[model samples]
Target chain A: MGALHEGHLSLIRMAAAENHRVVVSVYVNPTQFGVHEDLDSYPKTWETDCGMLKDLDKELAEDGNNLGGIAAVFAPTTDTMYPSGRPDQAVNAKGSFVTITPVGEVLEGASRPTFFRGVATVCMKLFNIVMPEKVYFGQKDVQQTVVIKKMVKDFCMNTEVVVGDTQRAPDGLALSSRNVYLGTRRRKVATVLSKILRVAEMSYLREHRLRDELLGPAEQLTKLLLMEQHQLPPEERVNFEIDYISLADPETMQELDEVDETRGAIISGAVKMLPVEVPQPGEDLGLSDGPPVRLIDNIILKPVKL
Target chain B: MGALHEGHLSLIRMAAAENHRVVVSVYVNPTQFGVHEDLDSYPKTWETDCGMLKDLDKELAEDGNNLGGIAAVFAPTTDTMYPSGRPDQAVNAKGSFVTITPVGEVLEGASRPTFFRGVATVCMKLFNIVMPEKVYFGQKDVQQTVVIKKMVKDFCMNTEVVVGDTQRAPDGLALSSRNVYLGTRRRKVATVLSKILRVAEMSYLREHRLRDELLGPAEQLTKLLLMEQHQLPPEERVNFEIDYISLADPETMQELDEVDETRGAIISGAVKMLPVEVPQPGEDLGLSDGPPVRLIDNIILKPVKL
Candidate 1:
């Protein structure tokens, strides 16, 4: 759970400013990962992450306003976490687990269906262990943040949940530890995810409903098709497959059929990029995944008042 | 959840002895009751219950051992408990709830299927609200006690669960608020429930397996049949029915085939009793259920050292 990226650091910064004590838990929880997903391969730069946290604490302390700093780093082992934690391993794991209804099975998206259960269970465990007054998350994982908020209310958990803004690179690719998995070929086209969301956001301001701008029978299908019109030319980047693009209710994560601006919405998408055959002139790419790199991104959609 | 019976008082006594600050929550959580179950009819003598608790405090304090008394009484209203509690009440009650797996559905008996879910959720709310260092439960509710113990460990909650002994009358009828539901005639036969368990215990002490003693082979079947033989004849008391007599694992609530003493077992039973037709001479039975009253009782089964 810790690469100590700016996105995560931003949440820590917000927690430091707002709370009396800031505690960070940096553990790559195994239960949250699927059998096929990146559990074994997930990032674990513990020493480096701790170092960055120390540096950030020092830098924030330099401001001399004397805000809260990291109080503790709870990094327990998988056995410790799962002593009675995982229900799936019922035979082996003796720990009891907490699960939310309907939401885990549906709202978390059909791909990683059990994802929220893992998240919810672990978060409950952490809340019980840490007994914190407030917990924090980044808005990049909007649906996760929403699910956790619901879980807290449903369980009557005594902790408040706060979401921080999504941090991004200058070129607009949302920063992610998974972004490191996007090798050169996919990395070259990584910004397309944000580009699509940007177009969807702009179209939302004019069209109001993203579904109208995207594929589907209803109003404004032409503008929707226009929004999907790839901004990058075929020669400019390798081909990539669009997994899905839809407007979703921020809280429920259910796809919005008739999108409205009353509570705003989220434009979420995923893309799978194929390996590049030829190197582009004057371009440098970091070594990452040579295989297809699947990346996801989303943006909150609301009309701006003049 | 309060009737101040001996079973409940024993738990209070234990909590008073062990904890630095003891707190008791007295809320008959509505979410745990089914629509048809005794939600409206469930006992609610708040004043009498509070008076008894005050007497308990006085009794404990006069010992002069100097320990904490009942720190607070969390008797929140139904609306407050389910403020965002009942997900099952998706439309009306909006409060979030917590739930555990396996135990609630099976251990609570198939009749009250949603019973454990309601119990688990409300207990989570209470745990979050009170944040007590330790909580006490009566062994009379064997499965509920087991479920809560697992929930605490699984959630990594920093609370210890302590179970108290089951309190019973001299004749062996378990003390319960529902015992009042038994009229003068039915109360005479109430001891039949414990008689069944005693026979089963003797069978287990001899046969080492409750399943064999209660049901199967021809030889043990006679003893097992005797176990089912009620002490009170039909003419002596109102008609009653045994719903089930099953041997189960203490923790998982799963039915046990072969008995083992290492972990012990639970011998649980339920009886559906008819109302007494005539008032017995001289004895007074408080008004209770006009219709049939279904009662349940259980005993822990362990091998006796010879």
Candidate 2:
């Protein structure tokens, strides 16, 4: 997970600000990806990532009294991390592995079934390896942050888990490593993800409608808005789809039947972008020369809004 | 896991002797048991466990330089540990939980499918809560000890998992919590578990037959030996049964297809003993007052003989 976007940098900056020492792990965990998922195509810019880390360290140390700096970077190979060998055929792996139970089955997990199991397992391994006093994560992956928090608490792990606010592009698209997948034209339109969620948030605040009832329509409306607002030609709009838009109780991650007066909610969604492709003479990029890349973004909607 | 026999005490003593402080957790973890297993009938002797611990500390302290003392006893309630709630229906439990995959599926795990998952998860939870420098386990539960070692190494847990030599009674029956289930008569025959394993270990050393070929007849020979050695009346022998007998790789917990002369093997077995009734006439002791208690024991057969 090492393409070092501002969102990840924010967590690093926060960790540097808060802790005396920091260690960042930069490995694309393989177990987390399904057989058909983007294990191969996912970004890997280790050199750039290290340069950014060095810059951030210099920047942090330069801030007068800001003393925290990265102590190390754990970049383990697949063989080193999974000594039982690759988890491709997990059932036969010789090592003892970690899994997060039911919490791994909702929302994001529903879309990517094995996602949190991989996240929780790797995080636990990282926590053990680094033995950190505190850990930080970006809030863009709200479900993932929550799942890690549960693992820390349930396991009684010593480190504190801190969630930093999600960083965003100038146009408001959540900063993500996958953002590289967006074509120049689609990248401009990527802001639609947060825009749609913000719209749902405003609607929930004004209407006080049950989340379940509201989110379903909000998802459908986002499609209409995409068509009308983008003013894209029919051919350009052909392969686009909104995977899911959900309003769920933040901690439990269960989709709320209705928003009560007290507890707030989290609005999350994933979208597949059909962007202008970089044409190759012989290659088909599957849906208009742009690989169908899934981008996820989320925002918290405080139910008792002031 | 609170029966606190010599096997458990040996581990506690080892932990105390080696580390600066020792904490013994006595909760009977519910997740590790199957619905039909003996979770309900499992023994809980908290007071006696504490008494033994206090006695061990005094014995260790009296020897004068054993600086490590009991700093805490983290006997958490089910609610305290699994804040996500009890793992009664683990699949849907809200809190994050841990699992040690494949290794949990070999050998003992093959018989008790969910057993090692429960063991790995709880041990991780305990490791987090205790944050120990070193952890200890009796070698009697060889498979459990092996699974935990894999977890510690794989996850990079900070603590060292030290395996203590298995402790036994004067008669050489491996001490276990379930031994309490044996009525006086069957308790006498309960030694059969270790007795059979001892014979197998000797046979393994004496004969170089392939493990799979040898173990099958070794098991059949144990039943014959049990009848001949005890010379039990046919009435008493009817209720006893051999659950499984295996020769396995100690590290992987995989049943060895054949033994390599460089690395030895572990001879393990479990036997269910149905003893004479506890003689409370009107009590209606459903399964004939003598509980069907399953006891497990094992021995390491080093290939290089003197």
Candidate 3:
């Protein structure tokens, strides 16, 4: 539950088309975020979100059929969603939480271990409270969608889950609220992230074999982005800190070594926090007033298995 | 499922009346009965049962009303209900079965500890398959009703449970399939069971103090019947044996120490197999031919607050 974005709005459109009612719940669930994660700074544009819904409602209803079917937008507080105190206590009492170490142990899960658990718990609460016939989630958070699907199946939840494709910027960069934190020069460099992902997607879909064939092109793209597109000097090029890069089974979300029966690969990563020099050892880096940020991007590619 | 006795008929009738469609399941649920128990000989009256339902359907139709009523009778085979294997295996798996020990531990539970678990598992399967708006159970098994209620709450089942009161003979012996096993003389002796329960009810309503005020009478009545009521002389009074006489809380189904909260009492018991000969070394007990039938009886005393 985050602020309204085109990615989330696309999910709402999908929900409205199929279901009798569309209920959008906008709550920045505190349980899903780590103690150091952006729990406080998570964008929460409620008034603007409501305004967007009003505009969408009018637009959908403009076609004389009166499809104005937005039911309720729930923005619950932290206590209201996770009443048993924290996520751990909630999972302990319910014994019905989502976990797929078998699937999540690779890629995105490598960096954020508790990410899927947080997503699963909050989704379960929403499923129970809303009791929606169908719920929609954005594929922008591809790993989240996979985790939620497994949880729903394991728990025998009655709701049908629909995942809409990720909405991207004109430059192919995936839309994220964190993208707002980018400055003029950093924003120009961020375009390379999507550009690298596009290259990986094309190579994997073509006649690329598993390890040597796929890794060669992927490695070349990363090198090209750092050297040419970003125009980083040799010293600055060394500063590019990549979180994780890997091929994974699109369906199960499990990492692949040789791509056996691999339907697709979700190539994803985050640019690490930039280093800052300080006067004292204990002194804060304090780069900007806006706070530190990490830019993330992913491309879902169907592998051509030979 | 054991060949539709009057006990089962009462449940079917309640379902037909309340639900849009009533599915009278007739297959005997083998998983519920424990080993060494009379699972094999637990009655098989399906033909008669079906005829009874046909008559019931005719009666309902003759009234010129068929608003989604008595849709079908689902007598699924044992394999259909317990695809996993049997009741014992099913219950042990993840402890999914209803824990009726809280009530059973006190009264009838001591005699037939696993009885309620079997009942709950079979009932849950029935609820899941039928997905009925409402399911009906007999009050003859009062503790079973309580256990099922708790299970419904614990599992968050959507179906509503309706319990019909205990139906009895003019002499007050609780109607049961096992009653058929009672011989001419044994039949007369069976009336003592009901008479004792009624006495417990009277004593409870009359403000009887001590905890055993109710149990003492039932025990005394059983002893007197074996010694005097039957043709047996005082020395031959070993014909009937009392398994256990217990008083329990109606809500939690746990045994109570004293009759303080006496919102009522579920006075229940089982009659052990009688020895064939008195003062003889292992005579061939008539229990083999007639089988040492286990008969259970319960009476809910009016609330008697201490």
For each candidate, the alpha-carbon lDDT, in order, equals 0.71, 0.76, 0.63
Residue-level lDDT of model 1, residues B1-306, one tens digit each, is: 976787887787788777667788898877777667877687777898889889988888876674667777779887667664345532223334455656666745377765776787788878887878888888878888988887887778888888888899988888888777776667876776677777777767675565775434323433444444444454454666767766888877888887777777888877777676555566555445445677778888865455
Q: What TM-score applies to chain A of candidate 3?
A: 0.83
Please provide, for model 2 over A50-127, each residue's C-alpha lDDT reduced to its tens digit, 9 standing for 90 to 100.
Answer: 999999888888886655888788899987777766667232333445556566787778878777877888888888
Candidate 1 ranges with C-alpha deviation above 4 Å = A19-21, A89-95, A101-107, A203-250, A253-262, A272-294, A302-306, B89-97, B203-239, B257-259, B274-288, B302-306
Per residue, candidate 3 scores C-alpha lDDT tens digits across A224-266 of 6666634644333323455666666676766666555346567
Kindly report which residue stretches of model 2 are placed more than 4 angstroms away from their true locations once superposed: A65-67, A89-95, A207-209, A226-238, A275-289, A303-306, B65-67, B89-95, B207-209, B225-238, B275-288, B303-306
Candidate 3 DockQ score? 0.06
Question: Which of 1 and 3 is the better model by TM-score?
Answer: 1
Sort all candidates by DockQ, best to worst: 2, 1, 3
How well is each residue in B1-306 modelled by candidate 3, as lDDT tens digits? 655566766666666565567777666766567666777777787778778888777766665444434688888876666553343433233222334334434455556556765676667667656767777777777777887776554345676778887877777777877766654445656666667677777777777746678778877777776667357664344466767666766776666667555466566666653433433344333333446666677777657445
**Which candidate, 1 or 2, would have the higher DockQ against the true structure?**
2
True contacts kept of each: 0.54, 0.74, 0.00
Reference-based TM-score of each model:
0.83, 0.91, 0.57
Write down the TM-score for model 1.
0.83
Better of 2 and 3 by TM-score: 2
lDDT tens digits, residues A60-95, model 1? 677656468888888888776877534552222323
